[model samples]
Structure formats: structure tokens, C-alpha cells
Target: MNRQPEPRQAIALKYDGKQAPTLTAKGDDELAEAILKLAREYEVPIYENAELVKVLARMELGDSIPQELYRTLAQIIAFAWQLKGKFPEGFDPDAGPVERDITPPK
Candidate 1:
């Protein structure tokens, strides 16, 4: 007996420092490949976390991620920003939490 491999999943997020991280794009299989390819072509850093992807994929396009996912997604965005040498003001990699609270007021 043979088991088929799981299809690859890809998700894209957008954060403008003024809003919650939003689900920009998500797909499986071939579409995932296309999204990943574009990321490579543009030198975008790719973060792979199957659990995170599974959670984020549940959100609709253009929807900001839920509050529960803020801390997890913050790490991803922080790393991406660090890679581009644009660390947020007062951010301390050694700190337990992000120095700045980017979450919008309720």
C-alpha cells in the first residue's frame, strides 16, 4: 500500500505597522508553488510553520489575523523586519515580549 504525500500549503501576510497582520494570499499545491516562487524571485523571507499556516489559512483574504495569533505572527513579522535591517523602535531580541504594542485599540 502507498500513501500520497500531503499537498504543500503557502500563506502570505501583510503588516503595515498600523494594522493587524492581514492574510494576503493562501493556497495549496500548484498555487502554493506559484506563491512561493514569487517570494523567491522577490527575495522575501519565507517562514514555515505548518500549524501557523493551518490557522492563518482559515482566515479570509483581506482579513486581519485574530488576537490569539498576534504573538505568534508577531515573531514572524519581527524576524522579517530584522532581516531587512528595519527593527522596530525599542525592540529587544532578548526581551520576552515585543517592546512596542502594535495592536490597535479596541
Candidate 2:
């Protein structure tokens, strides 16, 4: 049987050291293309997880991601930070706080 792939879906998230990652943008098809283009132009790190994207695409812009996604998203965020040689302040591998602890905005 022949099968067709799903249309592209993309989401942009912003994470602050103090707060949960927020949904900055989301799109499908052309919009998804545009979002990816901008990310490329800005040299932003892109981490693709089809399953995560599906869940995130459901969120509205400015919404903090749900709690359950923390661990997986944290790993992705850590990867981005590593790529940039950036890390949270006061973080010590031996004694620092856990890397991620963003509560959804009230």
C-alpha cells in the first residue's frame, strides 16, 4: 500500500532560566516553512521531535508548555545550550540545581 507523509508542523519555544518554555510560534505547511526559514537565518538551534511537535503545535503562542514534557524538552534545551557554549548561571555539575524546573504560568 502507498502512504503519504503528514504536512510539516513547526513550533518555536523560548525558555528562560526562571520560567517554563513558552510557545513563541507555531505553524503548518507554508507557515511552518517560514518559521524554519527564520530559524535558519538567525542560526537558532533546531531540535526536531515529531511527537513533541504535534503536542506543541496545539499550544497557543505565549503558553508555557505543560509539566509532563519537562524532561524531554529539558534535554533538547540542554543540547541547544551546549551548542552555543551557554549555560545557566550558578550551575555547578556537582551541586547545582536541577537543570529544568519551569512551572506553567499561573
Candidate 2, residues 58-84, lDDT tens digits: the string is 988999988888877887998899798
What C-alpha lDDT do the candidate models reach, one value each?
0.86, 0.86
Residue-by-residue lDDT tens digits, candidate 1, 1-106? 8999877999998889978888899999999999999999998899999888988888899999999888778778878987988877876666675356756466
- Which residue runs of candidate 2 sit more than 4 Å off their true CA positions? 1-4, 92-106
State TM-scores per candidate.
0.81, 0.81
Clash count, one per candidate: 0, 0
Name the TM-score of candidate 2: 0.81
Which RMSD does model 1 reach against the true structure?
A: 3.2
Show the lowest summed lDDT stretch of 10 residues, model 1.
Answer: 97-106
